[model samples]
Target: MNNQASRSPVFKAMLETEMEESLSDTIKLSDVSHGALCAFVDFLYTAEAPLDDDMACDLLVLANKYEINHLKNYGENFLISKLNWESSLKNYSFAHQHNAKTLLDDALSLILDTMDNLNEREEYLELVEKDPRLVVNIYEAYYSKTGRCCRCHQS
Candidate 1:
């Protein structure tokens, strides 16, 4: 990594802003805000992101904590760019909870296809009930094409 990457004006500005926001709260709670967070943010901004587990973990948590959607999304995409089953749920849930809708949709599709037989009918119905909009959209798609939900697609 270029050592001077940390000296960029843009990266400095963002780090300063984020530290100001996060440190005050962290300090009040006396959580001992490590300078590593700033260093990690600097790395994210300047250098190509480090692909190591330690760097990835730090970025994932920091992105979500700072509400940095782009960084969070970038980290999510990075985790996915090299896929592994063990990390899937962790990354997907983090992305979904932080409002990464497109990623969430992809993750859910994978879950649905791979784990279809794992859930009982009642569980599937409950999921649909919780997100009734999904059902409505499916029904609407069918209705628009042929009128009414097909038995195969209906909740």
Candidate 2:
């Protein structure tokens, strides 16, 4: 892709720096899904993508990787709209992984709102086993909202 066609700062910078020498002119995005890369390129060209829940998650990762703030925000909003009890923990983890603070906080809030039954879910158990730190963070957030420290229970 030409530098002008790349709206992403990361991609644009890479193209500018790497294309200067031009022994080979290819950007390898091995980690990004085919669908996400395609949608990202389409968005860079036309400012649009056929976003859905699955695509939004994939696109968010691509957006974050490329430092494309507009597409990142779009992906965050789409994920927020899809959030619910069933998707909270997964979204929370995904948001954290992608450095999407807004989505992470929103998902955490929903998890706290339903904290009474959160542990009953299979996902919760799986999360606790896979990443105990995240479960601890959830409790920390819950206690903070109630005006107490999780460690000492002080106001």
Candidate 3:
């Protein structure tokens, strides 16, 4: 049996003996990139993983999937610390998809704070085209925070 005492409870649950032999002996993570999978395994063993924006995003997904709250928080914090207006939209979308509450709120705040110029950006247009609901959420957040519609201020 794997030494799972150091792992998160969710991870340890996957080691129950009644699971399939393949699952009991080896966990397959075909959805995660090889690099992210390696980093995840490294974190499992050492409780440390190298983080960058790309790696952080990748690991955040894996952390959430495996219910490793420490890694999830680490990834969210790393992304938040690195966030800028240029990347906030994409990060906001990523955070929303991954359920990273802190990162999501921070990125949404940045987006709303800079909403005056947001629609003029190519990324903003791309977001509108690809995920109109997220754009609507951004507008809703803007109104909730400022007590006025996003359209009220548009030139």
Kindly list the per-residue Cα lDDT of model 2 for residues 54-145, writing each as its tens digit: 99999998888889898899899999999999999999988988999999999999999999999799999999998899999999889988
For model 1, the stretches where C-alpha displacement exceeds 4 angstroms are 1-39, 44-47, 84-86, 117-155
Predicted structure 2, TM vs. truth:
0.88
TM per prediction: 0.46, 0.88, 0.87
Q: Quick one: RMSD of model 1?
A: 7.4
Scored against the true structure, residue 119 in model 2 reaches a CA lDDT of 78
Q: What overall lDDT goes with each candidate model? A: 0.50, 0.86, 0.85
RMSD of each: 7.4, 2.3, 2.7
Pick by lDDT: 1 or 2, better one: 2
Top of the candidates by lDDT? 2
Candidate 1 local lDDT, 65-128, one digit each (tens): 5455556666667666654444444444545556656555565554444443424445346546
Which residue segments of model 2 deviate by more than 4 Å? 3-6, 18-23, 149-155
CA shift at 154, candidate 1, in angstroms?
6.0
Regions more than 4 Å wrong, model 3: 21-24, 149-155
